[model samples]
Target: MIVLHNVQKKLGMRPVLRHIHMEVKKGECLSIVGPNGAGKTTLLKVCACIHQIDAGSMYWNGQDVYKQLTEYKRNLGWISHHHFLYENFTPVENLRFYSELYGVKNCEETIKRWLKIVDLYVFKDIPVRTFSKGMKQRLSLARALLHEPSILLLDEPFTGLDQDGVQLLFHLLQQEKEKQTAIMMVTHDFSHIEKISNKVIFLHKGEIAAESVQTEEKHIKEMYKTLVDER
Candidate 1:
């Protein structure tokens, strides 16, 4: 589980996140939604430890992340807008490099399995530079899930996906959920992943304007519209 207590962050002189508080338990998915510049992405970065909070604390399974940065990071997987891939490398090569960095033994079989899971097995040896946007996104996802981290931080993962790609993503997410991986996703479109989400927070101006527990999808949608329309 991960928890944030009154977290705050600033970009230069401007405050980006203010008094943010949230929790994500294993097997749970939390969706963050808001208008542009609402700091949704920043919040995810903070949770991923990519951005440090200027104030407050973030904890992983009861331990303060700052105190055990390396260990904490080992349990995290993050995906943002950028593919973060080596364009010149093939899908297999990319995964191989990551697997090596992660010190994952017997990665040969694991890499193959993930490539097949993402439906990119046939193109595993092709350079990423030649793959389409949706294909690149799929490969990125495969990289993220390579280590089977305990927590996932995602930012707009569905942006460039086609119908089949979306289904593949959903399928992988479901598998991760079953494996008890905690997930926090930032998205404007929640229809695809809503069923798997256990919580939704409507953020506004770096604060949570509205929140809903699982099973309150209707309430979440209503509040999302109200919040976005009001802004």
Candidate 2:
């Protein structure tokens, strides 16, 4: 399980995450929704350890994440607006690079399997620069899964995807959830959130305006609009 207690963060003296608190259990999904500048991405970045918190505490199971930073990071798989792939490298090459960096055993086999899972195997040998945005997104997903991390921090994971890509992502995430990987995602698409998320949070101006457990997508959107309008 991952837990946050009174988390706070700032970007250049402007508070981005304000006294935030949340928890995600193994095999659970948490979806965060908010209007622009609500710090949804910043929140994910904090969880991913891309940005250090200014205050509060985060824990993995019973261990302090800041104290056990290296071990803590090994359990995280993060995807944001940036794909973080070398455009000049082929899909297979890209996966190989990350696998080696993560010290993954069976690197080749794992890379091949994820490529097939993401429907990128046919184009695995081609450079990422030659791939479409949707294809690059698929490759990015493949890279994130290669290490089988216990936690996923995703931001707008459905961006630039075709129908097939979207469905594939859903299927992959479902598999991850079944394996007890805790997932935290930021997305405007409530339909997918309703399908996969057990918890939903609405944030406004870096604060959680409302939260619900197992809410319907329609209600979630309704709550989101209401919160945004109140701001």
Candidate 3:
């Protein structure tokens, strides 16, 4: 499980996240939603340790993440709007490189499995620069999941995906949830929030304005409009 207590962050002098508190247990999916510049991506980046927090603490399984940053990062997987692939490398080569970097055993088999899972097996030999945006996104997902990290952080993962790609991603997320991987996503895709996430947080102006658990009667969309749109 991952927990954040009164977490705060800033870019230069502008505060991006302020006094945020949240948690995602094993096997749970939490979705962060809000309008543009609501600090949604910043929150995810903070969780991924890409951006340092100015205050508060982050814990992974009861230990302070900063105390064991290297170890803690080993269990984390992140996917962002940028694909982050080596454009000159083929899909197989890219995965192979990441696999080796993560010290994944059976590198060949693992690379092959993820390629098939993301439906990129057919293009595994082609350089990533030759692929379309949707193809690159799929490869990026494969790269993030290659080592099967315990926690997954995604920022606008569904961007540039086609219907088939979206369905594939949904399927992959479901598989991850079933495996007890904690998932946190920042996205504006409201339509599928209820389907994939068990909890939702409405972030506005760097703070959590409202939150909803899956068991709640109010739909996520309704809460978004009430807390985010109204303000």
Candidate 4:
């Protein structure tokens, strides 16, 4: 459902991403693991169309991304380090607000379902800023999933998540995969790929250095170490 063709990106005069090519099909979860300054985030932003790719092209599903920005974006769910919810608003309130913005039809049911799925039902009435890191992360996941976009792009999704929180969120992602949601995750940790991802994309030196199907070995950590040391 996602394709990149000879994509290149630069920050001022410094190249951050170079001629990257990758694809993820429906129901596939692709994990991206790379070192700091390795262009992992840049690659995600380029795919998400949050940043303009300097050269080559990107296609979502079949249409060129730049040609149909609104339609293409409507099909994506992006979760990042930044929180889009209002801190002063309650979890339910924040979700309701977004539901309206997205013009979601079943707003109330969607809100309840996500809160319960994230186990934030009891805290639904509480303001978001008062929440701990883990709670806020859960709420962020809820907000991203409300419209049920076909593709999910998550950057550092496990940040601030406690052990149990991490497990819960992964379980929800598994459900999304079962329902044929395409996913591309940018993460430093490899633990969840065995369960969630169908393929692994490893970025090194601002390019796609390794690509492999998931195996019993979540090999990115070890392989990245060896590759970096050799360089």
Candidate 5:
């Protein structure tokens, strides 16, 4: 449902992403993996229509994303590497407020359901800033699902999680895939790629180095090792 055509981006004289042509099929889960400064985040922002491309274009379901950014964005959800919650507000407050903002129906029911899904129902009245990174991450997942978006963009989603938290996230991805939400995730390695992503694209020096379809070759960790060795 998302497409990028010969896309290029730069920050002043430094190029971040170049000639990035990619397509995310409806209901597919694709992961972008690379070393630091490999332009993973930059590429995602361009595809999400949150950053301007210096060259080429991006589209969502045949609609030019850059052209109708505001309208196109309503169907998209974002989870960044940084904390996305209000420090002073309780979890209950944040979820309730966002539900109203998104004009969600059965808002309270949805919020409660998501909170339970993320295992944050007990801490509903606690301030987010006081929670652990894993707790915050769980709440963030609930927030992303708040609007029932069709496309999801996640950046460094596992940054602050332990093994159990990571496993929980994997289950969440499976759930989203079942619901046919197109998910684009930026990950650090291949160890977790197989369980979480159906496709893996490696970004190198602002360009797409390679793409692997899960198909029968679900050895994500092995392939990722090969990619790293080849360079």
Candidate 6:
């Protein structure tokens, strides 16, 4: 389980997140939704330990993440706008590198399996620089899931995906959830939120304006509109 206790952050002199509190247990998916400048990505960065928080603390399964930052990162999987891939490396090489970095056993077979799962098996040997945006996104997914981390953090993961790719990602997320991986996603696509998320947070100006456990798509849309318009 991941827990954020009174989490706060600021970019320069402007405060971004304010006293944010949330938790996502094993097997639970939490979705963060808000208009631009709501600090959604910043929150994820805080959780990922990419940004130093100005205040508050975060924990993973009762352990202080910062105290064991290196060990904590081993259990974290992050997929963001940045693919974090080596442009010169082939898809196969990319996964192989990550597998080794994560100390994954049977790396050769694991790399091949993930390449096929993401539909990149045929292009496995091709350099990533030549791949399309959607293709890179697919490869990024494979990279994030290669080590099977306990927690997954995603930022606009479906941005470059087509219908088929979207479905593939949906299937992958479902599989992760079933394995009890804690999932936190930041996205503006309300259409699929209910299908993928069990809990929703409506963030407005860096604070959680509202939250709901009833994740019906229609209800979420309505709530989002009401909250945004009121602020």
Q: Which numbered prediction scores highest in TM-score against the true structure?
A: 6
Runs of candidate 2 exceeding 4 Å displacement:
none
Count clashing residue pairs in model 6: 0
Best by lDDT: 6
Off by over 4 Å in 3: 215-218
- Candidates ranked, most accurate by TM-score first: 6, 2, 3, 1, 4, 5
C-alpha lDDT score of every prediction, in listed order:
0.88, 0.91, 0.90, 0.86, 0.83, 0.93
Q: How do the residues 135-202 of candidate 1 rate in per-residue lDDT, one tens digit apiece? A: 99999998998988899999999878999988888888889999999999988776744667888888
Our tally of clashes for model 5 stands at 0
Give stretches of model 1 more than 4 Å off.
Answer: 214-218, 229-231
Better of 3 and 5 by lDDT: 3
Worst lDDT run of 10 residues, candidate 2, spans 72-81
Question: What's the lDDT for residue 70 in model 5?
Answer: 77
Model 6: residue 9 alpha-carbon error in angstroms: 0.5
Clashing pairs in 6: none
Better of 2 and 4 by TM-score: 2
lDDT tens digits, residue span 48-137, model 5: 777889998788889888777776777777887676789899888988888887788999899899898888899999989899988888
Error of 1 at 3 (Å): 0.4
Q: For model 5, state the Cα shift of residue 95 in Å.
A: 1.2
Model 4 C-alpha lDDT versus the unseen true structure: 0.86
Worst 10 residues of 4 by lDDT: 214-223
Listed per candidate, the RMSD to the true structure in angstroms reads 1.4, 1.0, 1.5, 1.4, 2.0, 0.8
RMSD of 5: 2.0
